[model samples]
Target: MRRPDVALVAWGLLGTVAASLALAVAGQLPFGLVVLDVGIALAIAAPIALRLLGVVIPDVLVTATLLAAAGGVVVAHTALAARLAPRDLPLLHFAAALVIALVFMPGQAWLRAATNRLVLRRSRHQQAALQAFLHTLSPELGTLECCRRALAELVRVRQVPGAAIILRDGEAIAHGDFDLAPLVHVWPRGAAADALPARSFGTIELRALPLALREALVRAHVTLGAGPILSPRRRWGHLFLNTGMLGGFFHEDDVEGFQAFVAQLALLLDGADLLARTVAVERSLAHAEKLAALGELAARIAHEIRNPVTAARSLAQQLSREPGLPWVAEHRLILEELERVERRVGELLRFARRDELRFEPVDLGELARATLDALRPRLDAAGIAAGLEASPGVVARADRDKLRQVLVNLLENARDALATSPSPRRVTVAVRNGEGVATLSVTDNGPGAPAEVLSRLFEPFFSTKQTGTGLGLAIARHAVEAHGGAIVAAPAEGAGLAFRVTLPLAETP
Candidate 1:
């Protein structure tokens, strides 16, 4: 199979041809010439024929035997045809060898091809299977099923007894022999790695990979193999085959064949990963587009609503100032209510419009006290006790109005939460000054937010309150981030919720 030992075949052919020609030339031999001719033909074809029958003989010996028989046939036939004398033998022998090589080499080649098909029947079968699965395997339902089918295809292609597909997410399926579990991501630590033999095929160390990969290889029983599942960017997974399934370990040709199949699987996984990311990006872009549209609509509505709101507030103020008005107190209440509506409308506009930050250094300690005073009436009405713990000279560089708005929203949320809190319905505003940062933590005695709702708290249109527009925390988060700060909400110790706002400390003046 390496290369035909042409010299050996020529010698064998020469000996057979010479022996037969000698008997023919002697002319006194019996009717044995015809019998020897048939024997010579079988002998010429036997070495190649033996290989086709799956008989393993030394390559050199088989080549020599086959070539010699072909040479014998040529010499015998030439001698019979020419019937030359012994002294003229040198030229005739040379002519016989050349004629055999030229005339029969083509036939030999065709015969060799025919025998090769027989010798490599399994390889041909594998090619057929790979071609079949090329169009059959698809990534649908899930990766697990698709990969499992791929494993089955490999089993067919390799003619292996069994195989397995172990997914990254912990699902495992087999070609027949493995009973995969619901999950097998966690590899056994320590001695449990010994279940599989310590051997490698390509770059895949079955034992060193994951547990699922190791288990699948050991079950197959072949270690000296090629099972590398590779990609240009990452390791998707691997493939393995049984060495003793139908025969022994995979031949050199088998190794070359599997490379293509494994590559296709790796490409599939890479494409799937890319597709998922693209879908996620598409969803995010659509969500952002919707948000942008809503922002424009909200901006227009706020501008239109502000006109009537301002006029109503001014009209109420003018009427309250009139002398001897019968409903002076009622008019005063209407003016106060109008002012509250105007303030609410202002918050709506601030939230809807993306205004650039008007950054200035502000004393957060003083601001916290002022915010509590402004909301003093609401606190009194709710029967909530308020307190402030401020570090001296706690200051931050931020947009004053926007930063105050974030604090007010946090405080208002806390106040509303504490409305039903027992006994000491308390709200604490604490400001801490540290190296290059200021942290404002607002805590209240109220039922804390659930763990499930904490993550989406800052997502626009997500809310817990019945009448809430759900923009408060979202707007607060936006404002804080605009000033290069961060806001986090979490359950407070024991009872209630806490909002921590951290901002960059202002340069000391």
Candidate 2:
């Protein structure tokens, strides 16, 4: 022992002996009573002395000492009572009971409190660790960022060298100087591990793991300690700590605190996910509102321009008929340009005006066939083969004109898409009914649009053609939605674009 420790021990023993002798002499107690009193004093002083020397006494040892001292006191009191007269026995017994109540009980309480304070010293900082972790949760940070920051905070609070968070999707965010890849590869999988409650794995437990996992952990110099981050709905991820190269382990208090922290982290992650989805929905709603306002503005502009364009076209036609006016070809070109403007204005008006649906049971198969027949001449002129594949009695609850307009727009769109394709180009319109829905698909053999272009196909005023108003698909979508249906575009089976429209099937009588 060091000189200071030895000197302190000597002084402690001397002081204890001096106090015991003083109690025996001053109280005139018998030798046996004096020894009993010395024993009791030592039981009470031992803990205080050890604490002063910075020694942490366990709760079990403290409890055992208190119980032993309490029993010894009772025995000493009984022996003293035996030496007393019969009349004084009851009074001595009463005094002994009072001493037990006033001393042993309170001493036990105090010692337990002191021992817990020493043994669970690290646990006292759990609140601080949690506060630090909570501070990392900021609205400006994303889920992954929050996770990384939380892991960083954990490393700091737990005094571990490194930590990592492995998400359910195999995405890992690591903080600290540790090899996370090997740990990730050896991470326990299957439902068993997922369903496990929060727990710690010490050095022996880690070494006892499967050969591959143990080898990986040993190679990476990481201590295997993890807690699952789970939610009522699904498993979020796992939190891992690298205790150190010495294969350290977590204390019971540390494990409990970690479990609480991970639980809080799981809640935050769930909230972050929910917030992201809500933000996306909000953005979609904002975009829709903007588009609605723009459509209204376009409608007003088209209304104002339509009147002047009509008057100009009428004047041009009249002058052309009167004679070879000085510039007849110029007049023809002016008339053609005016007609294009009028056509665009008409489309804009149709798009803006929400007409009441004239719902009726319409045969989708017949509609497909009729649309194909009406456009067959144009398809033939363009050397594009058009065919209809219809299922008998395939019908939908729709407005015939609106539904027909959708089909015409799709067919025309398909025809235009095939304008530059090689010979033997084909456009197939298929109509089928199943599961209380009618599906109409117009597919063609042509160069399909890229993914970037495909995403914006339904947006207002978004067109691939140079002279196209870009309102065709938009109008089609609006009409279909009015009838409580939907329209979608995708790449065709071989090479081209496919437009599919789904509408509710007509109810049977």
Candidate 3:
């Protein structure tokens, strides 16, 4: 710091010596005048010396300081050269030097501000950081790696106490000289807590944090501030930074610059999230299409084999009924096996068919009552207390037999679910009509399906049971969809599963 001041002072002195020598060579001034001129030049150069040493001065202060220095120089020079005649006195040179000093003061202030801005704005380090960040943020970059690179680049270029953070969804990554363990460990807690400031980006206090995190910051001798990285659509995460080393606080400009960087990062996060979701959706659509193709093939194969299976079953039945036949016992077993295959083939046919519906206005209340009555024997045998509730006037447009098949399938499934339950076994069926739709729900107090099983509950050939052919719910779905309705299964309010079927209502005539 002192080196620049020394050099500036030496240069000023050399200029003074050269001026003295030039005056002597020209024979324009006596020794007394030369001395006065040199003294004034040095006095006028005082502010320039201060500037060279990197001091920021307000315009008003600069003007006042320079004016004082100039006035002092003029007074001293006049008092020292008082013996010279008034006309011969070098007052003109002193006055000219004072004017230059006054001009230099304001000019230096403006020049300093401009130069600082140019240096900061066009800094090669910041540019390099941006380029590195772009290179790392290419489409090929993984989402987590992009976040990590962003943090690393910001921390490296900014040269603070090593601070950068990014969080997308629930995952987070951080970079800096300070260990991120404190923040990383607390992320789930921090993210879930509602105390985070609502500001988009700014310094946020961490005083209310957990003991371990606050202690970690204190031990590292750093004061931390949190800034939320957010786009207009979503908030990515909080960026925690310690802007200075040795626990120094951040200035307002530091906060603003950090916010700008955070905003850029938030956009990147948003793009990454959108890209991931797009890829997932595309994969899901492709999978669904593949499943549809498979189903069509299965239905075609089932249709072609139906005639053959029926012919074989007929031949086996004839063989079993043969009068005193030697192979009667073997033929009976074959006939039984044929019956099982026929039942399985029937299920496959029902699930694979997407046939057009035959909608008809049918009373759902009477249907619900009939279904419960038909299943009463099975429910009583399984020790399941079953009851049904159907609004008297509820009606719907559905294939009566198909809708009855759906209700029968759902009730049988519910009864099977409750068969072995150790808990209280009770099944309740409810039917209601409102808002232009009739809803039928079968709820059972049995062990409910888990999340993993619930996800594929309605998928064809996907079932949690050991002996299930996995087509009952699938067939039920087809039956309900054919009636222009929806069927959904979810865990009931208590520890049970509830299957709700909604069908569009037909006005009672």
Candidate 4:
């Protein structure tokens, strides 16, 4: 609710007195009727003030008060007329009051409407300034300093006594002189009684804004129309303001400007979110690149150091085979460990190489069959069967040896998974040509890779197996990527591991 403007009050009072005098003369009443007419005009003005101020001053109370006051004026005029024998004394008194009513209706309505419009225009100007302020909050320019600056500018431009931005996380932070947390936490959640059709009214306790501030607002004629700040994920706070004194209530335009201002702020917030995510992604990439370089260096060092160790161990094993060696078993054990180290070194070197591939048009079906045949001894030892279903002539341009290595890795993983699992232990290699692309999948009946490892499965030297170099899938990924293809691990429906590899077929010359 707002206080009435002094100018409007004065204008209504002045007009009421002058118009009441004219009506008195027209009805031929005596000059003494002027004071009576002025009194009646003041009575009418009070009720109109109460209505504009959003008070529930009942119509019956206004009518009863006016009728009782009018009755007294009538009785006095009738007594005076009886003494002087004046014509139409009762009619003249009634006419004066009617004139007051007629004059007050249009005058009061125009004043209220004009004041509301002025307030809306003032609010709109403030909103435009706030929109410009929000643009400065972009993180690309760096820091929350811009947001702080925007906050300050908002306070100054809006002439807001105080302003604050309270994050939904319950951070009670102030911007300029405004302390938002207290206001936000205690702000009304439901509808307002004086709710205008155009804008939502935020709850305002009369004590929160002083009469001086209210008077200044009415004097400045600031109007605000606003809505609650709400988000699907969280409760966003609202954009609202109290207009000091020049008050009639807000019109449609003020609400529109407020809603638009908040919408722009939301966009700025979204941009900040995107900028933060981009920074995170770049940091992740940098970290991944660093780790890849370190892995390559470690792999190279292993290859460089293993050859000499392997040669020395082979010599030791050969010498130990002679009858004179008392610790032959220990020497043999050393040789076996050295052999394992050599194998690991070879795996590392394979992972480290990033040389240009020697591309050739090769049949994926034939390549997969050959890989399976080579791993037949291991399959037999594990007591696992193999199923090969391939699309004929599914050719792609890639390094045949590298593709075969990828298939071998896939087969080895499938065989290992089968050995560890109960029930059926079988691996499937299926190749298909559809949707203008070729695909090959190796599936097995074993537990699927853990969700935690799935994202990092292609990373070098990350493995779950005790005796694994952890570079098998990583090398396989590198090989497929080199040929403009993709390989992915998925759970097999029936039982074990399933690896899907997709490749683009070569275009005909």
Q: Who wins the lDDT comparison?
A: 2
Q: Which candidate comes out best when scored by TM-score?
A: 2
Better of 3 and 4 by lDDT: 3
lDDT of 2 by residue, 404-437 (tens): 9999999889888999899889999999887678
Instruction: Tell me the lDDT of candidate 4.
Output: 0.64
Candidate 1 deviates by what RMSD? 16.2
Each candidate's clash count: 7, 0, 1, 19
**Given candidate 3, what's the lDDT at residue 116?**
36
Q: Model 2, clash count?
A: 0
Model 3 agreement with the true structure over 373-417: per-residue lDDT tens digits: 888998888898888887888889889989998998998899889
Stronger candidate by TM-score (2 vs 3): 2
Order the candidates by lDDT, highest first: 2, 3, 1, 4
Estimate the TM-score of every prediction.
0.50, 0.55, 0.52, 0.49
Which 10-residue window in model 2 sums to the lowest lDDT? 47-56
Task: Pull out the clashing pairs in model 3.
Answer: 162-176
lDDT of 1 by residue, 1-509 (tens): 11232444555677767777777778835544774676577656754554333323223334665678687777686766578777787877787677677645675555544444443335456665775775565544345566777777776655555566544333456675433342244433233433433323532443456665555444344343434455685554445554331233334565566676677777776666776777789998997788778778777887898899899888888887888888888898888877776666676777778988888899999999999899978987888888999999888998888888888898888877887778789899999987678999999979888898988898876888875767888889988988898999898998888899999999875
In candidate 2, stretches whose alpha carbon ends up further than 4 angstroms from where it belongs are 1-131, 144-259, 312-338, 360-366, 387-397, 430-441, 483-494, 500-509
Alpha-carbon error at 109 in model 2, in Å?
16
Candidate 4, residues 1-509: lDDT per residue as tens digits? Answer: 22333455666667767766776778845653765566556655653554355322223334454566556666766676677544666666677667556545664555444443443234435776778777656666532444345556756775544344444443333454333433544433334311312334432432344455344333322334234344333334444454443323444565566567656665565566568889989998997697679677977798788879878877987788788878877888888888888877877878776778898888888888888888888897888888899989898877888888888888887777666787567788998887777798988877777778777777777888888878889889988977898988766785456788888887766
Off by over 4 Å in 3: 1-135, 138-260, 312-340, 357-374, 387-410, 427-459, 463-467, 475-509
Residue pairs in clash, model 2: none
**Model 1: clashing residue pairs?**
9-67, 9-68, 12-68, 13-68, 13-71, 13-72, 17-72
